[model samples]
Target: MPLPGQQSPLMIHWEASPEKQMDCQQKGKNNKTECFNHVRFLQRLNSTHLYACGTYAFHPLCAAIDANRFMLPSHFEEGKEKCPYDPARGYTGLIVDGGLYTATRYEFRSLPDIRRNLHQRPLKTEESPLHWLNDAEFVASVLVRESRDSPVGDDDKIYYFFTERAGEETTSFFDKSHVARVARVARVCKSDVGGKKILQRKWTSFMKARLVCYIPYYEVLRSVCSLDGGGWASTVFYAAFTLSAQWRTMEASAVCRYSISAVQRAFEGPYMEYQDSTRKWARYDGAVPEPRPGSCITDHSRRKGYNSSQDLPNSVLDFVKLHPLMFEEVKPAGGEPLLVKKSVAYSRLAVDRVQALDGRSYDVLFMGTGDGWLHKAVVVGSGIHIVEEVQVFRDLQPVESLVISHAQRSLYVGAASGIVQVPLATCARYTSCYDCILARDPYCAWDGRACRATATMDSTGLVQDIQSGNKGCRSISGRGSLPWKNRTVLQGDDVLLPCDQRSNLARAVWLLNGSEVLGMGQDRLRVGVDGLLVTDTLPQHSGEYRCYGEERGLQTLLAAYSLTVLPEIPRSPTAATPPHAASQAANDMKVAYISAIVTLVVLCAVLSTILLYMSCLEKRKGKYVLGEPRPSSVELQTVSANCLRKGHREEEEEEEELTYPDGCLRIIPGEAPTAATSPIKELPVAVPPLPPPLPAELTNGMGALPNVLRKMNGNSYMLLQQQEEPLVSPLYSASFTEELSKILEKRKHTQLVEKLDESSV
Candidate 1:
């Protein structure tokens, strides 16, 4: 066949020798010649197969042979030809410049076929799919970069660094506009296929200026790197890079200067270094001269070439090795780029770095592996030096997640089987106390000693004892043991002191007044099954108490209690006396005094009145004279003659007549009437004693008695007569009869009788 632009005619022929003769001899039978011939034919084909890029060969060997082979155009079409080995399987390769290339065993497909099969139409209300990346197998990493032109705007771009089994691929597109400053970037899984997922992006705002420059780098083996920076004067810069392989690697660095805006367009001059000998900033013009063939660098400096420590000069090598480019510079006006923060590595296979949200850098790197093991390392200059590794679980189970609360200094590890946690400080030294051993703790266990939880000592008994100043003590004793002892007792009531004991048949003795009270034969005291039973509690019983029991041949005081039995109040004497009895006695004495005074007054008045009346009567009695003479003149002459005869007849009877001046009747006496014979001759009637003077009738009879009788003695003389009655006094009379009545009346009328006797005297 003639070539498109060639001129030589080519002729080919096959020469058969021993191998050809054996190949023909084995046409119908199997032999050593046939086998040798077949083996030679296969070898020839294998050599030709090894030359083609489609051959299954080692990477280094295949790469050397077809290093400059242009990609095939048919690999980009959506048909069986796109995937020559497996027509049914979807293509996964790279489409670059106008052709498709396979770097591994994967096939290839055009961008159009992927769009139709994987990409869905955008909702009417949603924004358009400005950036999209399908084919999960080809996507090894994704990163987002903020534009510096709109520092405060939400314009952010996404760069997808992918690698197929066959070749490396890259695609960049706008993700969202108006992204916030200091935004937090993360990847979330898409919710469609079980294993097929995509990245979901979100951000937070914390800074005044937006991120201006962001870039990502990766290798064909799926290693990833990133850098980002933004600021007013482009003075501050931060960068992060990572390489993911069998053993992962990470590098993070930062740099700052007074001003990055003063640099020129082409050369900002080589970065300076503080040489120890000179003690000054020395210009190092050959630091990172250029990125290598398979590498790229983006920054304010225009040196775009492969980067390697060997290729860089000493001055430039030290600058790049010590203070690498932290962030790429974005030239808005082609002047100095603005300042931003460090870029973060984004990879599907790389583990996310744990950082303190408080902006404090980590002194140690703590990584939780898919297998239930915790790897700890310290941060060195540019690498992590692993110090310890602990198998957190017996089985090699994957760890689901991890949570660290810095305030509590707690670390929680969530695993596929269960959850475990421990204090980070304690666990840092890998000591026995790192884990909790108490059986009751749900979230912790005892590695060997002490009580520990996720971040605290959840043992209630221990915590309570510690807080009460009995840190190492087992039980809370002292006042807390008997909660009811510090109590009050009411007067005249009994109180029980609880003495709880666990042992049966334990002899407990209570002491009072330095003597044992239990079994003392005292009726007031008793020993019950629990404690001492006090019958009557008195004020004297209130004192120190001790309960002792014999344990292991020694007297043990189990508890002590103070009992205060209050005193009973006394009753008032006055209130106890009966009111009615006292009042009656007082009334009786008053009546006696009143009666005596009235009686005495009446007696004195009666005596005085009686004495005056007696005096008057005596005087009137003297004035009255006996007038016998008038009758005598006429009787004397007749008496003389009778007297002579009376003497002779002395012994004979004699008659005599007596006459008063006021009376006409007369009695003649014979002689002197002989004492024996005159019988009779009423001796001149010794004139009957003149009648006692009659009392005058009371004129004012209001309080005096009425007159009893009236009599006329002579012509004009009037006398009020006193009626002589029974010998008994009328005042004492009950109709003036009965001796018993007289005595009773005398007692009843004693006052009146006494008055009358005084008047008579």
Candidate 2:
């Protein structure tokens, strides 16, 4: 109920109904309500009251937010040259010595004059150069600059930034730029009150400068850099520029910074005078004018009796009138642009210097657009990063004005409908360290408490290792993933694994049974937009399905799924079918069984009848035969070798000692007819030999054959009774235990016979 700092509360109520004025209902229809229009508490005249002005709505009303009564000068905008009443119009204002320094047009459309949308054109008048603002001009921002060298604060100057109709006419008629719109700025010394004569209540030293970049209007941000020894800091104004010319327009809105010193030199530099022959403004190479026009009265000039423009000669004033604009186009800051926007028109900008965690200072720029969106951009290592885009207004109306409260770490935006306040830092919204670090906003820091903002221009303790990528998050080791989920699916069915990591800064990878899965070329395995979808699952598909986030060479498991695939159940024929189908199948199978049993019975009876007929025929055919051998039949039996030629005995005789007549010994008479005995050489067999001998019973019932004279697989070795010890003795005969002596006596007799036969011969 009270002002920001007050001992007592001020009171207010809804004023007399606007229609109590019907005229009041129409008050805000075109512009804004009188009570809420750009109200400023100009000064505190007393404890109970204050001096204020709502320049656009209710002309200079001195009232509180809820004040029941309001007061102001009756002729605030009553005169034609005073403040404008149109809410659609804009202005720049400052208070000094009880008088308001306002720069804006005083007329557009009045209530009594209802007209179509019309543009204001500069009117030619005797005081044209004094009220320098052209028609159809819009005031953007106002600033008060003080001289750092001077101790007196009253020596300050006021600057108005805006866009207005350019004096140059284009080739096309009826075009928006037929009267080209150019970015323009005007500044006036605060010390100049006015001339009491012809220029009463008008500015004396009003001058302007052209800001070049892409498009110029609306916003002017200051760049202040500290210098050594702290004599004075340098300043620059970063402005945005654009163009409507289709042929030569900028590709994007370009932001450029112009040195404040250059702006001053341009104002005090050579002038651009009108050339009548070319009907265009050309540089004036003429000699400089005396006393220097359009400059504030300095300490040195005041002693010379020329403290203000009114005291200056007409020659200086005429020269200033012809060259109110600077001759040189201020060069922009080096680089492509501080910011570029192709389609969006940046409505307002507020800038602040931030100290990063790496101990570097960064300039953070907040630009508001006509689409009700605010873009927070941070200067990071030779590049600009837009950390976040916040939608301030619901209706997407143009963000008309912006203010930065550095002390509060908050931003206040003025829109077409109302004003909104928001925090300057949104790093807290990022729930994870990865997200917060990836934002690269110098104004934001984790700070271990929350994502807080630092106001110091040179600090970086919040994110010292932020440039090392996720190293800033290496200390963060908590889990935010959901609890492990268990899922069961029947074989041949499909399954999907959920991946719910919200940050896009990480890549999601799928794993099965602790092994990475190839996301591509797998018809059954793939990653979907929201999760991993596995088609036609098999038994091998049963395992732990994990989703891991891969960011900057680090892998983090985000979710796990214990997936189990159930085996298929085997069913009987009937069980495999529905109840209705099963019943029908049972009936059909029963009929098949009965038909099979009947066919088997008939087949058995037929086969039995055929067998009996065949048995009867065999008995009838065999009836004439007796149980004796037939007369015409003969039995061929195998005869024993003993009943044959006894050829085996000849083989026995060959082994006996051979004898011969001693015909060669007759020549030796003295030897008394010695027997000429020599061992006979056996002749080789010429014919094919007969088969080896078989035993007597072996020839006929050889199954019962004995071992006597048995054919031992073609060798006639004597058979021995099998002894307790089974040993193979091929060279040791079983009967040769005493046969060695017989052989010695037989050889002695043969020798004696040979000697006797030799003596007889």
Candidate 3:
């Protein structure tokens, strides 16, 4: 694709073979998109030629392009080892010294493989044992050129950075033992060839070590950028790492720097070996062979009669073959991440060394986010300050690649859609010195007049601060506060006071009447991303509002507003209704209200009256209603009333008269009934002997007899002689009563004789 203001984009028609395209379409379920040629890598092989590879449908293809003409050669080479067969799989390749070094999946299975092509004898990693790589995702590759003049002789190295699943050799927690995402840095000596006898066509100087970022677990490599710092001692690798998606709930990213010396030390450490008995990984305690296994063919090796890999002893090669993993990990330069950002997934990174107007150099990092934003940050001392954020793509898409062009002074961002060329220095965007200084951009400075790019102007009289911007640019601190705009808003209406911040590092704070507004969860007031919102404005809301941006303990007023909340206007009576009409309406309302109240009261009274009537009827029924078998109305003249005998009492010589009133037998307040005055005497029925003993049910039935019998014998009186044969009728017939009275009289006569005898005794 063409850059901005460049020539029209030159197109090259590259397609897969007919057979390959047909197979891919069939295998991918007729997905024509996947059948097209997808470019995987493009590396400058030389000044005149470029090496490019692609996933041509199901087949991989490679070709050399003319750099000047931007044309591909007619003939193509097999890209089996140089490119990935699966376009979605991660792979990295680099052309160093006319040799292509690649870490990729060579076949359809997506097995991890690292190889060096374009050599007399093409070489690759071990295919068996599978300990070198496990589901590896290649991120980047670089060639670190060694200093030929060093006293401790060292050979050039090709380092490959990738993330892979942890193997059984990892000593992490049980849950992470097999599936932990481990960031790894593997290096091979440039002069290394295959072993002589033990291993052939495999790297003899291959050694891999873990890359520890901030956390000790879940380190996944996202992107890597290599910076050449004059010598091997100064060279460093900046890597972006993120937690595995399966291990984190929120997205996070960190930038960690690895120095070359630290990596070398890790490689020189003891090897990690798996113990079958313990089923754990531990440092190897066995003695290492001389000339040190996995060491480059340096001057020391040359002096040990091992100048080349072919001359090394089989013992050394065998040891190197078994122990390729180092015990120590290559931690970050500062033993921690340079910067960690939450809710952001960094996809690509490009670092540029910027010479600022302050006569110092700073490393500016261009980090691409998954949300299609480019974050520019400067490394100052022990911290990183985010200078600005630029929207690279309108749609939210992960940035696939980032390229920095020092000559064009631009950053090229590549996504799934297209590439965007962003200028490295966006100085004119800063309108004032305060903004420019607050940005802390190493590429931009205030040239005593306007904010300008340091690369495009002279540094004399220019102000720039790569460190804390407030400390270096103290003269520009006393800038005038923003003019407060008067805002007149009616009560109950909402008011919005806007404030825009250019730097993401600055925290936006809203202050009302010289007090900080902490209305995070309040309903009446709120703090939005870009402004302060006063909802349902009242008299208390009338105050001076100011938005200040604070960064590194320095505060700058960005926006201000003088808010005046006026009372809500009341509707006029004339506008609402005429006075006479209003009076009539009020009278009607009052009458309607009184009518409703009277109706409610009347309804309640009626309901209460009905309830009272029902209660009275229920009481009358309970008082007068009889259960079953209605009683017979027998005259009292037929029944004889008598008192029950008291064994302890002396015999009564005289009995009181019993009176029958209203067909009910009544006795004097203290009177006993005698058989001679009984009504049974008047009845013509003959007397009978006493009957058998009555059942309990018969005794219970006799309780419903007339009150005359009940009043005799003390309310439930009974004749003692006939007590054993009590009456059994709910109401007695005249004949039955006569019979009962006759039996009772006979028993009474016998009882009287017994009583007389007892008295005489």
Candidate 3 local lDDT, 1-761, one digit each (tens): 77899999677888877888888877862455677789998889899988899999868899999988899898999988788878888888888788888998878875688898898656778756536787788999888888456677888889999987764354435365335778899998887778777668888888898898976556579999978756666788899988776665778899988889899899988898867798656789899998889888878888878878889998888888778888998998778888998888899999988777767778889999999999999888766888888888999999999999888988889999999899988899888767888888888888766899887767788887667686544553333567779999999999888888756667777777887565687668788778888888999889888787777666677888899999998879867787789876765433333333333343344345544644564575443222233234321122322322221122243332222211122221213244333332122222222223222222212211111221122223222222324543323345446543543443333322212222221
Model 3's TM-score against the true structure:
0.71
Q: Candidate 2 or 3, higher TM-score?
A: 3
Q: What's the lDDT for candidate 1?
A: 0.32
Which candidate tops TM-score? Answer: 3
The lDDT ranking, best first, is: 3, 2, 1
TM-score of every model versus the real structure: 0.20, 0.55, 0.71
Report lDDT per candidate. Answer: 0.32, 0.53, 0.73
Clashes of each: 35, 28, 1
Residue range 557-633, candidate 1, lDDT tens digits: 56777777767766587656556766655443332232333333433444455445445545754433232322332
| lDDT by residue (tens digit), candidate 2, 1-761 | 66778856533332323433345345544333543344432444345544444433344333322123444433432223334555445554444433445555545453111010101211112245332444534444333455557653225565666665555323344355344566665666766544435344444566776655543332232211111122222554556554455434433455555555666666777776666787666677888766676777776567778766567666766665566666665555563466666776676666777656666666777878778988887655544566778889999797777778877778998887888898887666866665666667676666554565555432444653345456666644333575779999988898878787655556787878876674857768878657888788888888888787776655566788899999877778865787888766654333333333333443344345544644564575443222233245322222222322334444367743212111111112222332233122332322222323322122222121121221123322223332323332222243332322333333333322212222221
The reply for model 1, stretches above 4 Å from the true place, is 1-154, 157-163, 166-360, 368-371, 397-761
Q: What is the lDDT of residue 229 in candidate 3?
A: 59
Kindly report which residue pairs in candidate 3 clash with one another. 713-717
Give the least accurate 10-residue stretch of model 1, judged by summed lDDT: 200-209
